[model samples]
Target: MLEIQFFQKIEFLQHRLVAVKKSVMVKTRKVFKNLSCLTVISYKFKGENIMKRCAIVTADLQNAAANKHAARIKAVEAFLPEHTEFLNKMRAKGIPVVHLQQIYDPNDPRKYKHTDYDKKFIEGSHEAAILDEVCQESDIIVQKHRDSGFYDNNLHDVLQAMNVEVVILTGMQSQICVQTTAADATFRGYEVLVPSDGVSATKPEDTERALDWMQKYVGTVKTQKEIYDDVLAGELIGGKHT
Candidate 1:
């Protein structure tokens, strides 16, 4: 009778140990599965909410022709007051704003004999200097030699350092400088925003074509008022515009 009782006790002990082991295994597997699911969710959220930097590019607003041309200059002038207001608001909000100015160097090695028209517009020429009235001391200025602001310029570096994700373009000669810059920005994977009223070209048709192309291929096109409203409403991130 004593031997039978001991054997029975051993069996009961063995069964309880086996049951505990199974429970532990099941709990471990469940925990590992939950961890894997959480990792995937975290990765998806990070990918979707990636932050981007913002900047404004102002092209050559120098010569009288750019400021006085009936269609080009007049259009820009009409929107100047509101544009300035929006820029000021952006500045107050701590958004990065960059102004691109074209500088012509007569002795530049890159200057080609075939481009006489370009040669004549030397650095000190009326066409090269940024318009005095429109440019402000607070604005950050970058100089470029060619139609594209990115060509042999510090634009890329500046934007990179600032972590710029989007560029707001405004300037003269929409068909040339503005278009080239917008295309380059898109190629670099930066969002581009062009305010139709903030830019001008030598001709209405040319400006229209450039704007249309940018809107279709490069980035979004919005009016000055829309931008201003966004800023005022605090829709933009970073900081509020002053």
Candidate 2:
């Protein structure tokens, strides 16, 4: 009878050990499953949180009726209202707006005899100064020496500080200053958006050609109305106010 009782005790102890081992195995599997699920959730959340950057680049819009043709001035004047509205909307949304003013130094080594009319105008007279009517006190102004705003300018640094990833280009001489800046921005890995109505050239044909080229290579060309609507819809980089 004593021997039988001892064997029964040994059998009961073995059964308890087996049950504990099974419980540990089940808990370990559950922990591994939870860790895998957390890893996937982390990746999905990161993918959905990517942010975008945006800015506006305006060229010198000075009054030069005598230097430029009367027709050119008329074109610029016609576009002013629309441009102002667009800029105001951008400002309201807290988007960065950069105005590029052309400046020239008589003694600067970069000046050349056959430089473009835009460059020559800056080098020669007061017409290079940005037109006061278009520039507001609140706008950020950047002075540029060449066609491209980035050339010898702190535009890139400023954009970097602002975390700008996309540039919405506008201003005078669509085929020259605007195009040059857009191309340079593209080369520098920035997305560019040129509103068809926000920019104008010396002639309609020039403007069309520039837009075509930009659409083909440099950046996306959109209409001002489209962008404004996007702004209103709260679909742009900055949240919509109205």
Candidate 3:
């Protein structure tokens, strides 16, 4: 009887040990499952949120023919065809194209009150329209009344939604609209790339000054061909801006 009782106690302890081992294994599996889920979430948050790395922002390239800034318009027009080809290549690579249109209200207090210059840019005026040579119906258009494209406009939101980490800024009036836009873009945390030949000013000195300022404090200044080649070779998209 004593031997049987001792054997029975040993059997009970063995059964308890097996049950405890099973319980530990279950808890371990649960912990590992939770860890696996967290790993997936981490990857998605870092990798999938930013779908695109670059966008082309053309600011205030409105009706060139009616524009009074003859010298600036002439400079921009010279490179329009080449710029359009660069845009085409960027578009083919699935980069977003954004055009900024400057529209002024005749009665708005912020408009230029001294000259009739603002009159041509009034809403629905021919001079306020974006150029057809560079803009397509499918492209995104952001209208603003100020020199800065981001001033009280949805441009930032649009770029955020597109996950654009870098902006290829191009347009008219290098020292005014383009410069302001580039500054704003830098403030908003987007890497800006201004093509030297893609933007213009009424005078060559003004253009040089704006480019130098932007390069020193705001963003990089490269030629249209250099930027186009990088875009085509996928170098810009891969976080290689130099």
Winning model by TM-score: 3
Superior candidate under TM-score, 2 versus 3: 3
Worst 10 residues of 3 by lDDT: 1-10
List, residue by residue over 186-234, the lDDT tens digit for candidate 3. 8888878999988876677888988987775567799988877766766
- TM-scores of the models, in the order given: 0.66, 0.69, 0.71
Could you arrange the candidates by TM-score from highest to lowest? 3, 2, 1
Which lDDT value does model 3 have at 32? 38
lDDT of 3: 0.70
> Which candidate tops lDDT?
3
Candidate 1 regions with alpha-carbon error over 4 angstroms: 1-52, 64-76, 107-121, 124-127, 233-235, 238-242
lDDT of model 1 at position 100: 85
Ranking by lDDT: 3, 2, 1
Candidate lDDT scores, in order, read: 0.65, 0.68, 0.70
RMSD of 3: 20.4
lDDT of model 1 at position 11:
21
lDDT by residue for model 2 (78-173), tens: 777888888887887777678887775555675463355645456336676556655667677787877898998898887777778778899878
lDDT comparison, 1 vs 2, better candidate = 2
Tens digits of per-residue lDDT, candidate 1, 78-153, equal 6566666667777777776777877656667773633655554465677766666656676677888778889988
